[model samples]
Target: MSKLAWLNGLPLEEAKAEFLRCCGSTRWAEAMARARPFKTDTAVYSEAGWLWSQTSTEDWREAMAHHPRIGDVSKLRERFKASGAWSEQEQKGVQGAGEDVLQGLADGNREYEERFGFIFLICATGKSAQEILEQLRERIKNPPALELRIAAGEQAQITRIRLEKLLTSP
Candidate 1:
């Protein structure tokens, strides 16, 4: 998928397939499928955000589960290999961050899940562990509805990144 895929007049199924290839989720795939025949890349991607807005909280959580926590790189095989893309930036967020902050993040993640029954999702694209931890601490106070919306926005960021990765081979 290149800029050409984003171009208008691509076959409807072809557009839908591209979206699914980027992120293989049922609702999102269908959403992109239904929104097909988009006249511009911005329009297609704009609707992608709208589609995420319509996703159920559970679905969003399922997506978040795909990501590993900061500093825990053992499980994410490919993602870890790609760590070069994120390591320095993410580590800087935790630079000089003591054990207490790490423990607090661990606790916060547990408490947040106990309250919401899902992981606290964030766009870790260029963020360091400390940045993500601090954000988690701040977001813990948010009411459920607000937090869900915030998580949705984060998911949008991740989805957009994945979409770009799928469209661009590097």
Candidate 2:
């Protein structure tokens, strides 16, 4: 059977768990689970985006907490084992990065969290380490309110990608 069919057939709690794996917000997961029996892949994507847009800053922070600091491969492997493999794959550009770039990401992540009260979030699926670091530096300069919205947007992109991955996974 198809993945979407499989998802639609899952128990409510199991469906919520699957959606939670895509995005960490409990509210979003629950909403997606309840909004189940989606008619098409497009419907799933649309609902994910709409639900994300409706989320509060608190919900965004809850989702953001699920991610490890960018380039922190060890933490990804250890602390975030549940989503570690997906994160590591999304951040593949970090692999074999030079020490200076890695250190910059580490330092920038600290500064970002200190400034914005959350981790530096980006859709790292296709971005290189240097590119991600450049974004981090530029985004760090944004005001708190603006940064929060930008982070939420990035999280939305990540959630969409994860949802696609989920539907395509064997």
Candidate 3:
């Protein structure tokens, strides 16, 4: 059977677990599981977006907690072992980054967390480290309320990508 079919046929708790792998918010995962039997990839994507928008800041923070700081290879391998492989792939640009760039990312991550009270989040799928750093530099200047929403929006994009990966990965 196809992946979508497999997902649709899973038991409720199992389905929630799979959805949780895509996005860490328990509320979003539970809701997505209950909204199952999606007819098409587009429908799944649409539902994911809608469900993410319905999530609260606390829920967004829960999802954000799942991601390692960009360029932190050790954290990716050790702390976030469950999602490490996928995250490593998404952050491929960091693999060949120079020491200065890596150091900048580390410092920026600290500053961002201190300011926003959460990790800086970006889609990171196809972005270079320099690009991500530039974005972090820019986005860090936003006010707390606006930055939270922007980070949540980035999480939404990440959820869509991970949903596609979940459906397509064997």
TM-score to native of every candidate shown: 0.68, 0.97, 0.97
lDDT tens string, model 3, 53-81? 89999999999998989988767878876
Worst 10 residues of 3 by lDDT: 74-83
Worst lDDT 10-window in candidate 2: 74-83
Q: For residues 1-170, what per-residue lDDT tens digits would candidate 2 score against the true structure?
A: 88999999999999998998889999999999999899999999999999988899999999999998899887787887667888999999988889999999999999999888899999999889999999999999999999999999999999998899899977
**Ranked by TM-score, top first:** 2, 3, 1
Give the distance in Å from residue 128's predicted Cα in candidate 2 to where it truly belongs: 0.9
Task: Score candidate 2 by TM-score against the native.
Answer: 0.97
- The candidate that wins on lDDT is 2
As a whole number from 0 to 100, the lDDT of residue 22 in candidate 2 is 89
In order, what lDDT does every prediction score?
A: 0.66, 0.92, 0.92
Off by over 4 Å in 1: 1-25, 34-40, 78-101
Q: Which residue pairs show collisions in model 2?
A: none
lDDT of 1 by residue, 1-170 (tens): 55634534456666665565444455786678777666666776788778877788777766665555654443445553433344334334555567877777778888888887677777776676677888998998999999988887876876787665644545
Best by TM-score: 2
Worst 10 residues of 1 by lDDT: 82-91
